[model samples]
Target: MYLSQVKSNGKQYIYLCVYVGTQEYSTRKEKRVYSFGETKKALIKMKRWKRKFNEFPNELLNLGCGMENLEEWIRTIETGITKTGRIFKTNVKRAVF
Candidate 1:
C-alpha cells in the first residue's frame, strides 16, 4: 500500500492506494483507493497507516500482516473510515446511495 495525494478545487486530498492483486500478476494487479480526506487530516492518517503495517514485506506475506489481512483492512475502511480512519458516526445509507 502507498499514500497518494491529489489536488482539486484548491484543496488537497490524500488516499490510501492498496494493490489487491498477487505478485504473480504484477503487470495486471488490481488497485483500490480509500480516501483520507483533506491534507491536514489525511497526512496524519497516512502516517498511521504506514506505521501500522510497515513491517510487512512488499508482498505483505508476513505472519502477522498477510495479504488476506490487508484486504480485510481495506474492506473495513471502504465500509467506513470510522472503522479505521477516525472516530465518528456515518450515515451508511447516504454514503452508499
Candidate 2:
C-alpha cells in the first residue's frame, strides 16, 4: 500500500491506496480510500492506521521472515522517549504512537 495524490477541479488531495486481493492472488487492482489534505499529516495518519490494523501486506508476512520483520516494521513507525527522557529514533517516519 502507498499514498496517492490526485488533482481534480483545481484541488489536490491525498489518499491511501491498497492493492486488491490476497497474497496468493492479486486482481492487479487498487482500492483507494481515506482522503487527507497535507502530505505529512496524511502520512502520520496512514502510519497510525496501518499499525492499528496490522495492515502490512500478507505476502511480506508470509515470506518466512515472520514476526521479526513485522516487529521491525512496527518499530519503524513508532518513535518516542522512555522514562529516562532519552529519545528513541527510527530510520522510518516519526510517529506519535
Give the range where candidate 2 is weakest over 10 consecutive residues by summed lDDT.
73-82
- Predicted structure 2, TM vs. truth: 0.32
How would you encode candidate 1's per-residue C-alpha lDDT over 1-97 as one tens digit per residue?
Answer: 6544567897766555666677574674545445657755544443355567564445334224454555444444344444346532222222221
Write down the lDDT of every candidate, Cα atoms only: 0.48, 0.48
Candidate 1 Cα errors over 4 Å, as ranges = 20-30, 44-97
Candidate 2's residue-wise lDDT over 1-97, tens digit each? Answer: 4444566675545554567765446554676644445445544645654566466445444534344433443343244332344553323455465
Lowest summed lDDT across 10 adjacent residues in model 1 is found at: 88-97
Models 1 onward score TM values of 0.34, 0.32
